[model samples]
Target: MAKQYSRPSHYEQLMKKLQNDFPGSEPITGLMLIYLKHIVHVVETSSDMIVKIVEDLHNMEQEETSCVAKSKILIISHDIHTRLYQQWSSRTLDIVEHGIEAFDTNETFENLIVDLLTQLLKLAVFLMKQPKLNLKNAMDALHEKVPDLLPQQSVVHYLLEENDSSMSTPSEFLTLYQRPFDTSLESDMVWPIPTRLFPYN
Candidate 1:
């Protein structure tokens, strides 16, 4: 007889809980759950794309590829970044329409938003550092297209220039990102719980 697995994986349990708790009966809860699910899907898909982009970059760097080819890769990366920002902006709007009070009461829901924001910040930083991708241009586009997407003290502001020497590690980045939220209740209310992204670190 085959051995039986008694324990469900964390992801499995989380999915089961989500299905049980948010059954799409109420309008607001259903909308929030749908937005959260979309956000998770975007993050997962974008992460996989980023990994592939990084691997391609490595190979191109090894081959000393032509500027045109590198430019094409940069364009693709920028497009991915834009799509993520748009998705995040849509999610934010969904939350705002549903009201922060709705989410603030639920610790698990708040934690999920925090996790999503952290992943987005990390991805943004990673993409910003890629060669030939103009960070300023990307920010300008986001500002024009999704002006209310990010708060005033967003982690995007902490992104280092290619020549800057400070805060190379992700931990350092998180520290810089968390400083603005330490005393601002308004910021806290508007955004997710700003803390270290990696709990184990």
Candidate 2:
């Protein structure tokens, strides 16, 4: 007979506590919280896996292990690397598609999406380097390269500082959609004629 597995009591308790702390009152806020939880889970899980792989590599090197054992370890490490890469790519695409939709209609929400995507991409790049490189050097390079992934201050800051009186709040956006167009600007106008007439002799 196979043993049935269950979640740990502490894990369940923690989940319940988090749910209570962050109830879904606003859609964007709830979505952001969900994304945070997912990113954290991926980072912790990938970090643990990488640490284990690194330890295994160290042990194999110290013991002068056989080529077969070393190859097996490398294979396992490669598999983990591939899995993590796939997850990052999928998540990136998902974030980008959602961001595009929000960008088209929801200005405030689009900013949040961009920020969230930036953080996720940075974390993904950091994790991607762990399987086959020196951790400290990889992180140093990553820190240097991070600016390339982020938006320039001129772009995002300009959007934040610009005072557009026409910008709509969420409630205003809903009301604007529901209301009919005025069409006042479409009315025709008359212009005065010039009074200069030439008298020919």
Model 1 residue 10 lDDT score:
28
TM-score of each: 0.20, 0.22
- State each candidate's clash count: 0, 0
TM-score of 2: 0.22
Task: Give the alpha carbon lDDT tens digit for every residue of 1-201 in model 1.
Answer: 001111223223433454455565311111011121111212222333334323433343345332212211101122332332212212222322323222222334334345445554654554445454564455445535444443322121112111233222333333443477547556568556677667784
- The lDDT, on a scale of 0 to 1, for candidate 1 is 0.31
| Whole-model Cα lDDT of every candidate shown, in order | 0.31, 0.33
Q: RMSD (Cα, Å) of candidate 2?
A: 23.5
* Deviating ranges (above 4 Å) for candidate 2: 1-106, 122-131, 150-201
Question: After superposing candidate 1, which stretches have Cα over 4 Å from the reference?
Answer: 1-98, 102-105, 109-117, 129-133, 143-201
lDDT per residue for candidate 2 within 137-190, as digits (tens), equals 543454355545533323322333343433332233334445887555422333
